[model samples]
Structure formats: C-alpha cells, structure tokens
Target: MGTVLITGMGRGIGRELARVLLRRGDRVIGTVRDERSISGEWSEFLASGQLRMLVLDVRDETAIRKAAAQVDEPIDVLVNNAGIIGPQRQSTLDMDFEGFLETLNINTLGPLRITHAFLPHLRRAKAGKIVTISSRMGSLSYAKADRIAYRASKAAVNKVMQGLAEDLRPEGIVAISVHPGWVRTDMGGTGADISVAESAAGLATLIDRVACEDSGGFFDWQGDRLPF
Candidate 1:
C-alpha cells in the first residue's frame, strides 16, 4: 500500500478520508492543528502505527517545511484538503476584505506551501500524485453569485495546481484538482446529497487511478472530468 499525506485531518472530509485510507491498508500521515483536535476514534490507528499525526496549520509555511523534514515516509499522494469557507457576511456589495484575504491565504496559498515543502519526498516515489480539493463553485463557466471569497480562492488554487502539474509532468508526478462533491460534512451541511463515507471512498478511488495522462485535469469525486 502507498503512503498518503493529507491536510486537515481533524474533522470532516479529511478525517473520513484518513479513516478510509487507513482501513484500506495505506499508511496515512495526517495533519491537524494539534493532538487534541483529532478525533478520539483515530487513536486505534495511531497506536497501530498506521496513522502518523503531525501538528500543522497549512497557512504556516515555516511549519509546513519543518513537518516535511520530519516525515520519514516517501509520500505517494499528497491531498490538500484543508480549507475554510469565508465569513457569511462576505458579498459583492458588502465585502469582508479581511476574511476574503484570510480565505485566500488558507485555501489557496496553504496548498502551495505544503506542496512545495513535500515535493522532494513526493519525487522519491516511483509515481507521485498531488490532489487538491477544490470546488465546482470555482468554475469560471458558472456565473452563480454567492460566497465570493470562497469561490475565488478555489478558482485561484485550481489554476495554481494546473501550473504545478505542468512543472512536475516531466518528473512523472500527476497533479490534479478534485471536487469532492457536496457531502454531509460541516462545510457541506446536513442537506447535502452525499455522505462523508461516499465522498471519501470515491475520492480515494479516483486518486488511486491518477496517472501522468491525467495531470493538469480537473475531476469530480466520481472520476468524471470537470470543466475548468
């Protein structure tokens, strides 16, 4: 089984993804803000040495680099799943500039920082894969007007990952953005169609099949290509 590193394993999709991966025999090196933040259910994997928890806030570049240095396992896949929805008050007419900036910093810049830090380890693997959890709301083709900051941030990161895929193509690293669908998570809300288990399972399957041929593409959790 391959080693997978995921950001924001404290809760939601990231946490479910970690569980699914671990249960499937993949060594999961997951990140959280701190030990207390992780779910108690993860304790079994921690004790079994299948899950290694790192204290990391993706927004902190210095901490990301340090965490990279500390990880001994060669990461086959790096999943950038940590993100935040901007304040509800943010809008086109009345904008929360500070929240918008924070959203960009964490949702966009955070993945870039983590990816750069882990590039060396990823390169060591025979075939590396980088999966950034983005959203369909980020699609420029759609003109829906709501949550401006969150949508803008995801859009920026999608472009960033596309560029990164190009840069890493020659090295045989597959980098792509994935939309995990609207799941029943804190961010997705209870009314969402899919459950966390479904999203995580589908995402893990999609990520497992990514190859150099799929680099720079945008895909949904169900393994369908998405319009950028």
Candidate 2:
C-alpha cells in the first residue's frame, strides 16, 4: 500500500480522498489547521494505525517542513488540496487586496512550500507523485471575471505545478494539477454540481493512474486532459 499525504483533510474532498485511500489499504497522512477539526471517521483511522493526522496550516511553511520531518515513511504521493475562496469583496471595483494576498499565500505558494519540504521523502519512494487541486475557473481558455483573486491564484499554481513536473521528471516523480469539478462543500456551496464523494473518488482514481508521461499535465476529475 502506498503512503499518501493530503493537505486540508479536515473536511470536504480532502477528507473523502483520505477515506478512499485508507479503505484501499494505503496509509494516509492528513493535515488539519486545528487538532479539533478532524472528523470522527478520521479518528477511527488514526486509532487503527491506517492514518496519521498532522496539525498543519498549509500557509505556514515552517509547520509544513516540521510535519514533513515527522513522517517516518517514504511518501508515495503528495496531494495539495488546501485552498481558499478569497475575499468576500472580490470584485475588481472594490477588491480586498490583503485577502487576495492571503489567497495567494494559501492557494499558490502553499503547495510549493509543502512540496519542497517533502521532496526528499517522495524521491525515495518507488512512484512519487505530486497532485495539486486547481480549478477550471483558472483555465485561461475559460476566463471569467468573478472571484478574480481565487481564479488568479489557481492559474498561478497551475503554472507552478507545470514547472515542478518538468523539474521532477528526471527523478521519476510525476506532478500534475487536477480540476475537482464544482463539489459541494463549505467553499463549493450546496448548489454546486457534484458531491464531495463523487469528486474525491474520481480524483483518487485519477491520481492512482498518474504515470510518468502524465507529469506537467492538467486533467479533470475523470482523467480527461484539460487545456492550460
């Protein structure tokens, strides 16, 4: 069984992904901003020795590095799932620049920081992978005006993952970004199209099939390639 590391596993898609992996016999390292944030299901996983819950805020690079050091096993996969919806006032006319910066910190740079911290562990594994959860809203081909901050951050992170894929290619580590669809969650809202379970299951399957050739690519939850 592979060891998978997932950020923002406190809820939603990340939590469901962790559940799917654990059920498949893969060990999971899940991160949460608060110790109290972990669900009852995850607590059971921890008790069963199938999961390790780490207290980490993806925005904190130092905490991420420390958490990486604590992981004794080689990480087969690293999933960057943590992100934000940006400021409430995200309109171009009256945007919250500080909140936009915070979004960049969590959405764009957070993955880079976590990946940098765990690269060595990943390199030691047989099939190392890096998967970043981006969004179709970020696609340059499907540009929209709303949620500018969030959209911009996702777009930027996509490019970062592309660069990471190129840099990690020789090491046999695959890096790809994925669009999880509009999942129902705290961020996605109840009116969203897909359920968290559906999106997470599809993403888990996609991540499992990520081969060396898939590096630097962006795909939907169903494994279909998407335009940059």
Candidate 3:
C-alpha cells in the first residue's frame, strides 16, 4: 500500500476516509487542528507506524511547511479535505464578508498552501496524486444562490486544481477536484442523503484508480466525470 496524507481528519468524511485507508494497509498521515482530535482507537496504528498525526490548521501555511519539513518519505496521495460550510448568512445580497473571506482562505487557498509545502514528498513518490474535496454547488452551471460564499470558494478551488494538474502533467503527478456528495456529516448535516461510509468508500476507490490521463478532470465520489 502507498502513503497517503489527508487533511482535516478530526471527523466527518476525512476521518472516515482515514479509517478505510488504514484498514486496507495504506499508511495514513492525517492532520487535525488539535491533538484532542486523535481517537483512542488509533493508538495501535500509531504505535505500529501505520498512522501519523499532524496538528495544524489548514489556514496556517507556516505550520504546514513545518509539518512538511518533518516528513522525509514519499507521499503517494494528498487529500485536501479540510473545509468549512461557510457562514449561515451567505447570499449575494446579504453576505457575511468576513466569513466569506475566511471560507476562501480555508477552502480555496488552504489546499494550495498544503500542496506547495508537501510537493517535495510527492515528487519523491513513483506517482503522486492530489485530490481536493470540492462541491458540485460550485459548478458555474448551477444558478443556485444559497451559500454563495461556499459555492464561490469551491468554484475557485476547482479552477486552481485544473491549473495545477496542467502544470504537473509533465511530471506525471495527477490533480483532480472531487464532489464527495451530500453525506451525513457535520458539514453535510444529519438530513443529508448518503452515509459517511458510502462517501468515503467511493472516494477511496476513486482515488486508487485515478491516473495521469485523468489529470485536471472533475469527478464525483463514485468516479463519474463532473462538469467544470
């Protein structure tokens, strides 16, 4: 199994994804904003070296760089999963400007910062893949006005991932944006359609099968191509 680094593994889809990868023997390097986020169940994995935890917020570039400096081995996959649902008062007319800016910083810029910091580890691997958790709400094709800030951030990140894929194509490093679907998580809410298991399972499978040829593409958790 390969080494995979996942951001925001404290809970939700990120946490579930880490569980799935770990059970299958993949080495998981999970990041959380606090040490308290580490589950006691992971003690065995931590002892065995199958799991490594990094405490840092995605918005902190310096912390990310410091964490990246501590890792000397190759990283086969980097999953940018840390994100926020954005402010409750998000709308075109009635917007929370500060919250919107924070959303953009964490959701859009955070992934890019982490990717840039850990690029060396990815380059050392045989094949590197960058997977950023994006949302279909971000699609320009959608005219929906709810959660405008979140939508805008996702759309921006999608464009960023596309450019990154193109730039890294010659190096054989793949980068893609994924819509994980509306699942029953803190961000997705309890009324959401799918379970975390379903979303995480689909994501793990999709990540495993993606190739350099699929770079710059947008896909869903089920591996279906999505419109940019």
Give every collision pair in model 2.
none
- Say which prediction, candidate 2 or candidate 3, comes out ahead on lDDT: 3
Residue 152 in candidate 2 has what lDDT?
A: 92
Better of 2 and 3 by TM-score: 3
Question: Please, what are the lDDT tens digits per residue for candidate 3 over residues 1-228?
Answer: 999999999899999999999999999999999999799989999999999999899899899999999898999999999999999899899999999999999999999999999999999999999999999999998779999999999999999999999999999999999999999998899999899999999999999999999999999999999898
lDDT of 2 by residue, 1-228 (tens): 799999999888998998889998999998999999877766677898889989988888789889888988899999999999999988778899999999999999999999999999998899899999999989999968999999999999999999999998999999999999999999999999999999999998998899999999999999999998
**Model 1 residue 158 distance off true place after TM-score fit, in angstroms:** 0.4
Model 2: lowest-lDDT 10 consecutive positions: 37-46
Clashing residue pairs in candidate 3 (N, C-alpha, C atoms within 3 angstroms)? none
TM-score, model 3 to reference? 0.99
Report lDDT per candidate. 0.93, 0.93, 0.96
Instruction: State, as a TM-score between 0 and 1, how close model 2 is to the true structure.
Output: 0.98
Candidate 1 residue runs with Cα over 4 Å from true position: none
* Clashing pairs counted in every model: 0, 0, 0
User: Please, what is the TM-score per model?
Assistant: 0.98, 0.98, 0.99
lDDT of 3 at 72: 89
